[model samples]
Target: MRLLITGGAGYIGSVLTGMALEQGHAVTVLDDLSFQQDSLLSLAHHPRFDFLQGDARNPDVLGPSLEQADAVIPLAALVGAPACDVDPDRATSVNLDAIRTLLELRRPEQRVLFANTNSGYGSHPDAVCTEETPFAPISLYGRTKVEAEGLVLESGNGLAFRLATAFGASPRMRFDLLVNDFVEQAHREGVLVLFESGFQRNFIHVRDIARAFLFGLENFESMEGQTFNVGLSDANLTKLELAERIRRQVPRLKILESVTGRDPDKRDYLVSNDKIESLGWRPSYSLDDGIAELLKVCRLMPRRPYRNI
Candidate 1:
């Protein structure tokens, strides 16, 4: 398969690119390198892996790549609530409008697998969120993804993954994600401050997320036109619960709750991955596995007075 992955140098994309190449698929990454990350540099020498630098929103720039794609995975977007709030216009353009561009320009036979966030689901802690859940996204970031997801699903040739809060180390590392952030703090300072610690959320390893995409590509015919909630069934956890899990690895870590904590990303839900699991996709990495892996990565990172963020 010839895969064209937009924003393929990102945290998730870097892992997916290598996995696809290893699986014997030709992979082309389209990344702006907005973070100036050389995450795909190691893959440059691979015969099956190539990269192009451009914005996903530009039709002229995106047109040529669309022509050569057998499968299109759009991973380019403003990732979080804070990121979208920074520039609402660009967020809408990249997150929502880019889907429009792809559907307009691509051939009907070209399959699209969109990356959507589970944050788009309104807080339903007591209830399990499925793909059938109605979207009530509070933040601009969530709203854009929810809208983009609608476009992709309605297109009839696209599939969407409502990804859980991804956790784990990647070639292009990120410490901002919940598990990675908590594990890093625990390993480095031996302490962490919890916010909305009681709110439930699901998690999947970053490598598992990459694996899910690869699975989607292989099973596109049976799964296309369906939005699957991709997550670990056993990994739904609260912030406090996650910290406690990390504590098992870093025994000296201290957990403290804030008296005045109000989280802006109000995404609390116990997501069910049964739909995809019914199709035989199961996660290999557990929450403890990610915590242990991150503890090692934290030890390797250089320490400064401040965080990389």
Candidate 2:
């Protein structure tokens, strides 16, 4: 299969591209290189891999790239709540419009796997949400993702994976995620700070998220127009529970809990991944395992500021 991954240079995109190539699929990456160029550097020499330095929002950039592709994995967006909130217009244009355009350009038989967020189920009253869960997005980012998912599902030839908060180390390391952020703060600053510590969320390793995409791609015929909640069912941790997990991993690190209500992006919802699991997809890394790997990587690297833009 020939696969085209937009935003293929970012953490998740880079990992997914490598995975596709390893499975003997020809992979092409279309990335603007906005965040960091070094993420996909290791794959520069692979014979089956290629890249286009361009934005996904521009058809002139993406049209030529999608000409002969069998599958399209649209991962290009501002990414995360903070980044999307920083510029809502840009987020809508790129996240929503780009997906609409991609769907318009795709043939009926072509498969598109959209990277939707479980954050779309923002602040659900129900503790655990499945694919049928009602959306109540509280942030600009979640709203855009919900809208994008609607567009793809309406198109009738795509699969939407409402992914949980992803952790684990990637070539393009991100400290913005909950588990990664907590582990980084604990390891570098010797203290982990908790804001709105009671908020609940689910987590999966970055590699496992990549695997979810593969599962959807291979089963696209049956999975099209279907939405899957992707993550470990047992990994839904409160912000405080997440912090405690990091503290356990690094026993010497100090844990500080603040009640000042500093969290602006208070997305709290436990997700159910049973839909994807029933389809034979399961997460490989547990929260403890992911945190330990992140700690090992942080110990080997020089301390740096954490940024995800």
Candidate 3:
């Protein structure tokens, strides 16, 4: 299959591109290179890989790329709560509006696997949510994702994967994620700090997420108009549990506890992947395995100052 992935140079997208290419699929990436272009350097010369340096919000730029695509994976967005909060307008335009435009342009036969976030569940009292969970987005980022998911489902030619908080390694490494951030901070400062440490979240490896996309693409017909919660069944952990996991990996790292603090983007909920699992897809990496890999990557890279915001 020929796949067109928007934001294909990003953390998850870059890994997905390589994975798809390795599986012998033709891949084309459309990325603005807003954050970093170096992530895609390794795949630049692959015969089956192609890239377009452009914005997904502009159809003039996205149209030609979609022309020959058997499937379109829309991963382009100003991801994360803080990034979207930093510029709400840009986030809505690119993340939400871009999908609306893509749905409008999509051919009836083309399959679209929209990357939706489990953050859309916001603060659920149930402690665990499924695809049937109600959406009550707590931040502008979550709100945009919820809105995009609605559009994609209405399109009837798309499937929505409400993904959990992703961690693990990627060519385009992101320290902003919970597990990665905690691991990096613990390694660099030898101390891990906590705020509302009891908050819960579900995590999956970045590579597992890429595999989910491929799984969805291969079974797009069965998944069309369906929304699936994507994550590991056993990987749900509290902020403190997550920190402990990181410390376990870096045994010498210190752990600091803070009780009087709050996260700016307060999305605290665990999600269920039973629906996607029932669809015959399951996550392949455990939190321990992912942490070990991230730790190895961290040890290899130069020490850099860590920033949460």
Candidate 4:
């Protein structure tokens, strides 16, 4: 398969790029390199890997990239709620508009596998969200992804994966994610201040996200026009519960819950991964597995700006 991944030099993108190559797929990565230039450096010598440095929203960049693609994975976006809120315009353009561009330019037969966030479910604390659940996005990021996911599905040859909060270490590491942020804080400062500790959410390792994409690519015929929630079912936990999972690896870590404050990314929702699991796709790494890996990597690379805003 000739796979073109937008934002292929990104956190999850870099990981997925390598996985696709390992499976003998010819991979071309379209990334602006805004976050990091060297994220995909390790794959520089891989014969099947190709890198294009450009913004996904620009037709000059995206049009040429989409031409030879057998399948397209749109991972280019302003990822989190905080990042989107910080710059709504760029978020809308890249997250939503880029999908529109790809759909318009690509052949009708070219399969699209979209990276849709589960944050679109908003604050559904009382019930577990499946693919069929109504969307109630609270942030600019989630709303844009929700709209993009709809476009992809309506295209009739696209598959959307509503991924849970991704953890674990990546070639392009990120500390913005819940589990990654907490674990990094515990390791660096030895104490984590928690706001809205009772808020619940599901988690999947970053590597698992890449696996989900591969699963969809292999089963594209049956998976097209469907949305699947991808996450570890056992990892649906509260903030405090997530902290404890990290503390197991970092035993001296102290957790302080603040009663006066509210979380800016107050996405408290339990997600059901049954839809994806029914298709024989399951996450291989658990929260504990991710925490252990992150702790080791954090100590090895002690630096700032490892995260995207």
Those runs of model 4 whose alpha carbons end farther than 4 Å from true positions after fitting are none
- What TM-score, over all chains together, does every model reach? 0.97, 0.96, 0.96, 0.98
Q: List model 4 lDDT by residue over 1-309, tens digit each.
A: 999999998889999999999998999999998875588899999998999999999988899988889999989898887788888999999999989998998999899999988989989889999888999988888899999999998887998999998988788888878888888889999999988899999999999999999999999888888899999999899999988888888899999989877656568989999988998998899888888898898887797657676
The CA-based lDDT of model 1 is what? 0.88
**lDDT per residue as tens, model 3, 202-257:** 89899999999999888887888899988888977888888888877788987788
How many residue pairs clash in each candidate at the backbone level?
A: 0, 0, 0, 0
- What ranking of all candidate models by lDDT puts the best one first? 4, 1, 3, 2
Query: What would you estimate as the lDDT of candidate 3?
Result: 0.86
Better structure of 2 and 4 per lDDT? 4
Against the true structure, candidate 4 reaches a TM-score of 0.98
The top-ranked prediction according to lDDT is 4
lDDT of 2 by residue, 1-309 (tens): 999999988879988999999989899999999865678888989999999999899888888999879999999988887888788899899889999889888788878899988888878645678888889887788888899989988988788999888998888778888888888888888887787777888899999999999888888888888999888788888888888888787889887888786544467888888888887887888989998999997886658655664
Clashing residue pairs in candidate 2 (N, C-alpha, C atoms within 3 angstroms): none
lDDT of 1 by residue, 178-296 (tens): 88878878877889998788989999999899999999998999998999999989989898998888888888989999867765679788899999999999999999898888878
Order of the predicted models by TM-score, top scorer first: 4, 1, 2, 3
TM-score winner between 2 and 4, please give it: 4
**Candidate 1 — which residues are off by over 4 angstroms?**
304-309
- The residue pairs that clash in candidate 3, if any, are none
> What C-alpha lDDT values do all the predictions have?
0.88, 0.86, 0.86, 0.89
Q: On a 0 to 100 scale, what is the lDDT of residue 211 in model 2? A: 93
